[model samples]
Target: MPHPILETTDLTVRFGGHVAVDHITCNFNAGELTAIVGPNGAGKTTYFNLISGQIPVSEGRVKLNGTDITRMSVAQRTHRGIGRAFQLTNLFPNLSVLENIRLVVQSKAGRGFNILSMADSHAELTGPAYEILERIRMTDQADQVVSELSHGDQRKLEVALLIALDPLVYMFDEPTAGMSVDEAPVVLDLIAELKTRKDRAILLVEHKMDVIRTLADRIIVLHNGALAADGDPAEVMASDVVQEAYMGRDLEEALANV
Candidate 1:
């Protein structure tokens, strides 16, 4: 097996007297899409936060390609090729789509000092910014202010922002949380496309089993801050432990309909 692009060893997180994430260890291999699923308060997002350096770990360590990054700050992790999209859409609402992406491109290029300059003057940044727009199918909306776009479009732009960072591992926390059923597929397709790249690793925290079933190469189920099940999607979903603890009878009915 290929060495994991990202890994955690006995990772733990505590909130005063409460434990948000128990001692858990797992590896995310390059080119794989691993779905982290569980009921509410399952520690799925907490795990993402720990690995992405959004929060400090109380125990264990996070490693990227064998390099220990447990002590790295959020920006430091981003600089080291870790990118994440939160459950809520993160975008510059007042900026045009292209402009929003351009800023990220500029920041990544270490040209934050020139952010006040005309965006058109920087072909190096604008060029790639346009390219990302094309990839996200947002080129036509490039000049539209983010606030003017639909909720789904804003979600797409958020993913585009992450793409602009060019991270080795992409962590998506409920990327389709508030999207309409029709809009959900648009973001899902983008994620599916990202999974096709052989050098990138994708870690997702999602509650939609249909989405998880369609895209996950592997599924990790968390319950009460501990791992409940981890394996192929079908097997994990079929497991009595998961069905009893998380999915219950509804999952079986859902799967039966399929």
Candidate 2:
């Protein structure tokens, strides 16, 4: 078999004596969307942190296309093709939406020094930035300061930032956390669109079973920081292990509620 686009071997992290993310060994491949699900505090996000280099690995290694990146910094991992979107908005508050994306495009192109000061003259940066904004349907808000944008719009912009980076791995922790039902589908549609590309792997950490049911190609259950089940979305979501791991709201209840 070919190598997975991303792999974690015994990945773990400890906060003093507490093992936030226990030994989690999993492989993620391109052209797939894996939804990491478990009860709150199950360390799903911590696992993402370990893989994305937001936290150091206490005892494991993360690989991208077979390259060990366990010791790399967050920026290094991002440059190496790991793109992460937070549960909360992570953007340049003072800058316009266009400027926010333009900076990332510039950085990805190894021309971050342009720094939006001479942004108008840098078509190389703005051209791609505009394209990403258009893709996310944020072209109208291009000149609005990020701080001034609504929470839902800010969330959309964050996804746009990830798109601008164009990484091999896309990590989204509850991509629709604070958006209204009306606003959520725009982001979900974009995720659906991204999943079409065969070269990118999308990792989503979401509790909305409906979203998971609709977006996940595979579902991985994490309980107490350890991997519990991994397989087809329908099968894994119904497995005894998954039912027990998600006792807070069993699959049946989650599905019924949806």
Best by TM-score: 2
What lDDT score belongs to each candidate, Candidate 1 first? 0.87, 0.88
How well is each residue in 162-242 modelled by candidate 2, as lDDT tens digits?
Answer: 888989999999888888898899889989999998789999988887898899999998999999999999899769997
Error of 1 at 153 (Å): 1.3
Clashing pairs in 2: none
Model 1 clash tally? 0
lDDT tens digits, residues 65-124, model 1?
Answer: 899999999988988889998788878999999999998898899888764777689899
Assess candidate 1 and give its lDDT.
0.87
Superposition TM-score, candidate 2 onto the true structure: 0.94
Residue-pair clashes per candidate:
0, 0
Tell how far residue 8 is off in model 1, in angstroms: 0.6
